[model samples]
Target: MKKNLKPTITASFLAIAISAIACQNNSGKTAQTDSLKQDTSKFLTQPLISNIYTADPSAHVFEGKIYIYPSHDIEAGTPENDNGDHFDMRDYRILSMDSVNGKVTDHGVALDIKDIPWAGRQLWAPDAAYKNGTYYLYFPVKDKNDVFRIGVATSKTPAGPFKAEPQPIKGSFSIDPAVFTDDDGTSYMYFGGIWGGQLQRWKDGKYDANGSKTDSQKEDEPALTAKIAKLSNDMLSFAEPVKDVIILDKEGKPLLTKDHDRRFFEGAWMHKYNGKYYFTYSTGDTHFLASAVSDNPYGPFTYQGTFMEPVQGWTTHHSIIEVKGKWYIFYHDTQLSGKTHLRNVKVTELTHNADGTIGLIKPLKK
Candidate 1:
């Protein structure tokens, strides 16, 4: 009876061991299946940089590579020495990406506000362009007198060690400097914001020939009207009179009269596609990416409406560029830090409709 019981016990133990081994093998197979599923079903990701907060993405295609110039957002004051929101950013970082391998190379600080002799603080929205053989960078910074001024920096390469000009462009007030060159060997600079000012002209380093104030300037006019003009060969100043190219409403009327919906706040980007001028900007409250179009760079621009919506922050500065047959909208959001001022830059593929209008871009989280 004892021997029979011992044999039965051994058989029971072997059955339990076999069951445990089978379960382990099955669990491993299930995990492998899940891993493959996750690898296959992936979504489009954005916010190109995550380790640090970057704002005001200004993208440019240079020599078959995509270079992004963005403002670096860092913790300003310490907890012991609290100083409000502290949006105190002082340097610019240039990031380059050539493929979708999810690898971005940071070229380090391109420009520092402290490096400029005349500038004080707030190294804000910037733009870049390649002309003749030089790469030019345009930035807006407050001067020692506490006035916002536009400045230019030059570099032999896109990702620079840029050498800033001795001083800010004279007579240039307000912020957000957007430089555009047309197909006809023409260049233009668009600028101004707040307090009812949006002005531009040829980048010849000069103002209007008929003088700046054409009509009797009103103190109470809308502050968001964006303007454009031709640029000179050197792109140092204006070459033509500034024209108000503010977006037009659906009814073919200026946006200022009906509402400030499509008016420019800051960050004006110019892109020409298929013989049409694509003028894009950050609208009032810095929440929407609004655009307009016309046959000419300086319009009669019909407001095309908002292409990109607001993110988790207050500001939505951006740039539009075409790279290797792909159009991308480079913008910024606050999803990383949750604070409005600590924003990060992002990019997504932008598409245009058959009618030449831009399609609404859905922001992605990766």
Candidate 2:
């Protein structure tokens, strides 16, 4: 009876193994489908606000709601007075939505340029974060000496009449301040812009020089670099040295250039998903919203390519966030004003690939 039984037994085992593998594969596909899937019914429409020109949208989730702290742009420059650069912004407004498909409410002006002692009139890009139940707003403005500096404002609630701190964060001389808090309760700040500058600093007020501002050598300086740093426990200052994180192409090489088609301009936004760091930015001159990714927060990130193109030829700036399991990108356009500098805040649902890469976002006209 046992003369030829070994071969039969082996074949039976192999058949069972193959069936189990097939079952497992089918299960995995189902799970992935459920995870990557989303319902569009819950998403709010683009151009979150209509009456005002809002730019540089920085979004944060606090107490189950998404709050947007954006720069309020106004038409102040005339041909006789402007130096050809007409982005005349002066204050910030806080807008919030209660539910996934809820209406956006303008909480009105949260902070003003006149309230900040160290800042000048041009209040540029801003960001907000929540910590230990307190909300902190970081803003970039020209200093009294005409130098750009990042300043902080604080509020007890998400929608505030936020009070500005008297002085700028010392040693922070650039635009766009993005704050990120990690899982371990540690916080970090990433910032910077044109002329070969991109920097990071810790919450304790220490700058990360590994990715700090580098001096330009060429006549057309390539300054599309972005940077990151850890933040102190209080979240009011830098806690570590800044690192100039490099954005590389898909081939794992740096996309070295100053042109918008290949480089990062201003509007630095940081987001973490599935333990990966996504650094999203606005491309200079071209006005496209581009992105890069890295395993570590302070990275030498690999450029993933442009996710969103220009909105009617206006410069685009944005932030990405996930609320209630749905992803969204908050950006700005000139639909309301029809002018380059006067932009209005917009929001649309964002999608990611199974590999954690973001998909290209086409601006919605509606």
Encode model 2's per-residue lDDT on 180-254: one tens digit a residue: 887877777888876322232222444344433332324265344666767777777777766676887788666
Weakest 10 consecutive residues, lDDT, candidate 2?
A: 23-32
- Would you list the C-alpha lDDT of every candidate in the order shown? 0.65, 0.67
Q: Could you give me the TM-score of model 1 versus the true structure?
A: 0.76
Model 2, which residues run further than 4 Å from truth?
1-45, 78-85, 195-224, 364-366
In candidate 1, how many Å is residue 338 off? Answer: 0.8
| The candidate that achieves the highest TM-score relative to the unseen native structure | 2
